[model samples]
Target: MAATKERALEAAVELLGTDGVRALSHARVDERAGLPAGSTSNWFRTRRALLGGIIDWMAEQERADFSPALLERPTPETIIEGLCTVFLLETGPFAARTRARYALFLELAADDELLAPLSRQRREFERWTDRLVTEAGIPDPVPAARTIMALGDGLVLHRLTVDPELDARPVIERAVRALAASVG
Candidate 1:
């Protein structure tokens, strides 16, 4: 079951990341994941179920990677900027394939059934930012963190929809600087 489920996730991420996820299918996933045919349904019972499982598991993986404890650095601004840096670094050439995969992961949000998990993940990330905002003794930290999230989201949207070539570093740096100034 574990192996099968893992394969399903690998397949889903692969499909969703490539081809805009509009073409994600069990057969295609099986080929991409190198799993036996019908394994996705064997584990998730349905397409939505499979997508949800992967989404949830990925959230857990990310939460583990970027735990609140990862912010042991003294300054909230530095910590927040460091967090963005991770995203910036991760989306570079080394992770281009994975970024493509992430594009597919996010496409699930368009489906109401699949969107539930995505929303939950987004909220969890926002709460982490909200906590930093509160701890930093900044005004309207929730909104501040939310704006950052929105900017990041917009950047991703732009990358996915408009221009994959557009550089997001400058804008991210600007926002982080502005937010830091606000908090300081």
Candidate 2:
């Protein structure tokens, strides 16, 4: 039963990533998950409930995937590299999940009720970035953090469609350095 729920959420992520929000449905999730026809409905009961489950599932996956050691790095370069490594899907492991997250973000923008989790995530990221930038002795930590995050978002979005083959490490390093210098 637990495995069934896990497979349903994983299917939701894959469907959202590949087919966009409009393609999500209990039947589709069930089909994708290879579960019985009513499995997703049995678990989620309603569209809203299913969506909430997906959001919760995403948050849990992200928390599990994140590395706390990345946050403890003392140098800005190392910190930025660690951050970019996740954003760029450098190991090719998180590519689908990352794309699904972006797709969910777009969907969240249009639905106010679904925005809370994403909003909290964004605020948490901003806070973390602000702390990191401040530790680096950068001036205007808030603005610097915002700029760095925006750069990362733009790069990820662009990479998703424009050039999946592009190496993002060098680009991310240069951008982080330039932004850090600007605030220094």
Could you tally the backbone clashes for each prediction? 2, 0
**1-184: candidate 2 lDDT, tens digit per residue:** 9999999999998898878888999999999999999999998999888988998888778767764557785457866777677775622676667777777788778888887887777677777778888887667778877888887777777778887776777777887777767733
lDDT of model 2, residue 101: 76
Q: What digit string (tens of lDDT, one per residue) describes model 1 on residues 72-138?
A: 5426566556656655544543243345436645665467766777677768888887887667665
Off by more than 4 A, model 2: none
Question: Every model's Cα RMSD, please?
Answer: 3.5, 1.9
Give the alpha-carbon lDDT of every model: 0.66, 0.79
Q: Judged by lDDT against the true structure, how good is candidate 1?
A: 0.66
Supply the global lDDT for candidate 2. Answer: 0.79
Which residue runs does candidate 1 get wrong by more than 4 Å? 74-76, 93-113, 159-167
